[model samples]
Target: MATVSLLDVGKTFPGLDTPALAGISGSIESGIITGIAGPDGAGKTTLMRLMAGLLRPDSGGLTVLGREPLTAPELRLRVGYMPQKFGLYEDLSVLENLTLHADLRNVTGKERTQTFERLLAFTDLHRFTKRLAGRLSGGMKQKLGLACALLGTPELLLLDEPGVGVDPISRRELWKMVHELADQGIAVVWSTSYLDEAEACDSVFLLSQGSLLFSGKPKDLTSRLRGRCLHLGGVEGRRRQALATLLCQPEVSDGVIQGRNLRIVLKDGAARPDPSALDISGPAEWKEVAPRFEDAFIDLLGGGPGGESALAASMQPRAEIRESLIKAEKLTKSFGDFTATDHVSFEIRQGEIFGLLGPNGAGKSTTFKMMCGLLAPTSGRAEVMGIDLRRSPARARERLGYMAQKFSLYGKLTVRQNLEFFSGVYGLSRTRQRQAVDSMIESFHLKQFLGVTTDDLSLGYKQRLALACAAMHEPDILFLDEPTSGVDPLTRREFWNHINGVVEKGVTVMVTTHFMDEAEYCDRIGLIYQGKLIALAPPDDLKADVASAALPDPTMEDAFIELIHRQEAS
Candidate 1:
């Protein structure tokens, strides 16, 4: 049965020329996960709000559970909606928040008690009921929010990017719980920027710039690219260079580094070109690989930018430095009796991309904060460019650049204003600031958005502006904390391409991310768990350590989960 239906729905916000959602029509049925996916500002949230009856369409019709959601007050009672930022009071205990939501939803008496017990058990959050919501891990908080939303026993559930920032193990657990809910005949509508999640759904609606591009099974879209996907082998150490060259080719539509090889998609019906013809050095082999949902999505979006990073090309190369640019020597941080970072030690050399990966509350962020001089360590030292962070944090920071997980820029400021402000903060002279801002506007393609406020820019453009601000100072070292958290795959590729270009110019990078595939791009990875560094190795070596007879070729995620499980077992 169709739980929600849209008939040529259209929505337009005041003072905006373009409609947020235009002529949208789709059916969300019961007992299955219906995925709504698109890039940033693709009307996903708008459509979801319309279904939840939070906003009424300006044109066309929308029905939820066989009733006009805008006209039916009771429809809200039978529908549960979890927005991207779920409202769970940080100061309240998990149990208290649940009780509050139950009261608001009018769940009363014995029924409330029964619902609380069932939800706590279902989300595996019973053990932490007394813990404050702010103290819970990213995954735990998500579960708490879900529990609160499910309090009214709604027939339909809406989740917007529920897996964002969640580690793979926790994401897997959440997926299991959601599937179990669907098994109980509840309709699930999951909106996400992760294409892999969309591929897992029973059906998907792909939107772009306020239009419905595709609505069907993910495999049905993936099958359209059969025989077009190929894995270019023998790239090995030169994979990034080869990928850069391959992307410039007219025949290649999309390409990315996969472990030690380059996975690429040729334009539809385009002849396969030889590696030598594309100017890739040495012997290379091409093997046909299965098409992924991302490939098809990018294809539908008119393919990715088919050239080297323009942002990288505009920057000047850095002077050669043979020593470690960043070093954390026995770093330890503790809040009272709880240790957040326990004796973590690592060194990042010049031009190397070092990754620090861990589950939530696993000490990665603590170690990062200590290294960046944002937090004082209980013991040991953090040295950047041979200068101690504790003794001279300002000097150390002057030589480094940091892009936060949330893109910490003034949202109300315009693009030009943000660039000018960051330039001035970096201590550029008046003339240099003007030069830098002009160069950034041109390189990042922000000229059109110069007058637009940061709050109104698309996520992709916001990311571009953030990178521009971080790199405009031409710092020797860069720190990225979950830099690609909630963006789509295409934007992620673009961001990495720029990072690769900068690394080639002798910029050292220290990054932390939950995306295991992105981990493949790192030179070496340090796995932190329970406030201790558990594993440190190159990406291929890490995967090889966990490879087994049943799983001859383990992925980065597989290695990560296995290593963490092994540590816990020990």
Candidate 2:
């Protein structure tokens, strides 16, 4: 059955002439997971909301489960929607939240109990039922939202970036649960900007500017850019900088930084260079490589599709640490019986970016929170620029900037207003605030939406705004937690450009994220698991260690998987 259908659907908000979904037409089948992929402002959410009957389309036909969704009141009962920013009762316990949802849905007695129990088990939140929803971790909150959405066994499900800001293990679990539900004939229309997850879907629809760009299976979509990727490896310092500058030139479509290596693609489809022909002005090395799904996506979106096999082979790696900025000596945090973090230690050198990596229940959050002074450590200690995090938190924080997992600014205020407010909060004088706000608005390309309420802005804009606010004070140390979550690939790239600029200025960064690929951008990484620093080294070292541990040709993903499995086994 056609679980969801839309024909020439269109919508335009008041005062905006451009339709959010311009003549969009598609059909999502029953029991299938349809991924809606697009960049920021591509109308993925608008389409989902329209399909869920949350908004009336300005024109065209639309139906869910064979009925006109907007007109049929009963359809709401059979459609489960988990919005990007789900509204959960923060003060209520996990079970209380679920019970409230059940009460609202009129689900009662044995059925409710059975359903809740099954969901809790599936989500692995059975032991956290007594915890307040507000106090739950980011991943746990996401699971709670999903559980609430599934309260009534809705036939059709709509999830808007459900896995964004969630830990990798939690994401895998969520996908498993979604597939299990789909196996029972549930239709799921998931909206996401993460191309990898989109590639895993049964079928995908690419949206651009409210228009359909492409719709097909993952293989078909990626098949368009085969044999176009080039893998370059070399030494650090001058060589790394030179390569980055070269790859990010106007001639290159995309450049992925992986430790001492790079995966790059040309902007214009062309023949690959011979390994001997690779231009190596610096001491670093290079090598020809195969194309990846991300490479194909960038190629298709930016230039014509095609590539060559000839490429350069790279040499050995050499790294040089400039100066130590932030150092942690056995940093630890505990919540009574729960040891959230234990004896974790690391250092961030000046002008270098460091990444904190781990699975869902890892000690990353606790460690980050402790470093940022959001939580008191149970034991151990940390320092930022030699200032103690415990002894002189305020002094240390004066030189720090933080962008939390879920950043919150005044939603009702305009983007400019929010920027101004944050500037003042960061202790900028009136004149400085004006200059900072104007500079940010211009640089971030937020001028067009300066007067627009932040509430009306899309997820991507919200992230950009949050970043601008964080950068207003230009702190020496920056802490970012999943800053690129839910952002489109293009925007993510742009965001990284800003981050790179910041790092180049001798800023020290400590970031935690679920994007394993992004870990390659860091100069060094610390892998935390079960409140301990399991591994701390350069990205290539970690991967090499994993490969040495018996995984042949281990990529970062493989290393992470092996690391997590080993931890679990022990």
Candidate 3:
């Protein structure tokens, strides 16, 4: 019998026009990893909440472990759930957190000790047992959350976005540990926005607008796009324009930028894209290839069927490349004896895309903060557009823009109000501020949501508003700190499209991200490890440097991990 069975299950919240989940039906079995895949606001989180018996369905019947999920008192003890933000007591040590969880689950004696040892070893958290939870890295906290959830050997595990804010290496490790649990006869259901991660699942459930889109094996979905997907290689320079053109084509189902190459899927009976049709100054190549999970996903969403035409804004003309616009010479920052950044130096040219990457707590963000003048460097010098930040921080800030990782907008304000507030913050005149806010509303498609409170908007709309606020001043340099975290993949593509449009107009961007795949979008990447710059190169070069015959097809994540390992060995 299936571990979970849903029959026409539905849920709706009061005052909401659309149901959060509707007509959802599926069966999840034991001893396998089942992936729940969807875009933002697709009811992925709602389904998770329902499965854990935290919410009652408004319609249909649901059974978990052969008991009615809504009223099963024993289910709580046998199921482990980690919400999007897994709560870890910041003041408690790693060991203390685990102990508290064990106490809650009533685990005692040898069983508790044995579970603790096994979990610490599996999660690589033994050395950090005494360390406070607040000090542990983003990845470590996720692992610790899993360790706490497994205190009583729960039969079914539900993880909702546990990997959302973590680094690639730690994400891989977390997935590896979860697979082992499934191997031991436990059922695992994890939700994610990344299709690449979903493809590896034993079974996948694709959700859209709270309805079931596709379910069953991941391979079955990709099979539908056989002979339709093509990979365009030898692509260089600004990828935004090329990607934008392809996505707008009637024959193209979907397209994305991937490490100097463009991966696309065509509609049935659609002709191949001719290189001559692309607006380019040089040669571009193309070839038919096997479709990835993302290709199939795009197809399922009425891929070639098209979306809001407003999103396909025309690309601005390429900007002239000037001298070094950003310079960091032997930049270093230290907290007491701990060095967060050591002797990091690099230069960013005008209109260039620079990516900063590393594991959690690897000082990548610290370097970004220093360069943005958010935090002062303990030593060394940095400059933006020839202005010395150390001597003139405020003047340096005026020439730049920033989008923080978290939602920085005020929750109490409306959409237009947020834009107006940001414009004022940038010292714009009342007339200019009104004009800027109106322009932002049109550009970001905030027409329909002008009156909605920022907190009440969907995640995708919230992201668009935040971006609009960032670009309201039209600064030359833009700093995005994990700008796309928690957003759906399609939304991420749209966000990049806007970014590409700006870059074409001579705006330089410096970004830090945990998504290894996003590094492909950068013109150059700098990888930091243990407060040191270990690797600096294009994504393709970094991949080639670590790739061997055994792993010729290395991903950005693989290359990143290899670089960190090399640094440690040295």
Model number with the top lDDT: 1
Candidate lDDT values, in order = 0.89, 0.79, 0.86
Candidate 2 residue pairs in clash (backbone atoms < 3 Å): 234-285, 285-314, 285-315, 286-313, 286-314, 287-312
| Cα lDDT of model 2 by residue, 1-570, tens digit | 688888998999888767788998889987889999887888999998988888999899998988988789888779988887767999999999999999987789999989998999989999999999988877889889989988888999999888777777777778898999899999988888888888879998888888888887877867665555666665445434444465545566677677777666765566543333344544444466766655666676774211210100111121334657788788878787888898887778777788999887788988888888778787888887777778888888778888988767889999988998888877887787787787787767798998999889988899889988887777787899888977888777767766766665556788987898898888888999899898888988988887863567787877777788888899
Against the true structure, candidate 1 reaches a TM-score of 0.96
Across 89-137, the per-residue lDDT of candidate 3 in tens digits comes to 9999999999998998888999889989998998899999999999888
Report clash pairs, candidate 1: none
Clash total of candidate 3: 0
lDDT of 1 by residue, 466-500 (tens): 98898888888888899888888888988899888
Model 1 scores a C-alpha lDDT of 0.89
Q: Give candidate 2 misplaced runs (Cα > 4 Å).
A: 103-110, 248-250, 272-290, 303-323, 373-376, 408-438, 548-555
Question: What is the Å distance of residue 384 in model 1 from its true position?
Answer: 2.1
Worst 10 residues of 1 by lDDT: 233-242
The estimated TM-scores of all candidates read 0.96, 0.87, 0.96
- Give the Å error, residue 258, model 2: 2.2
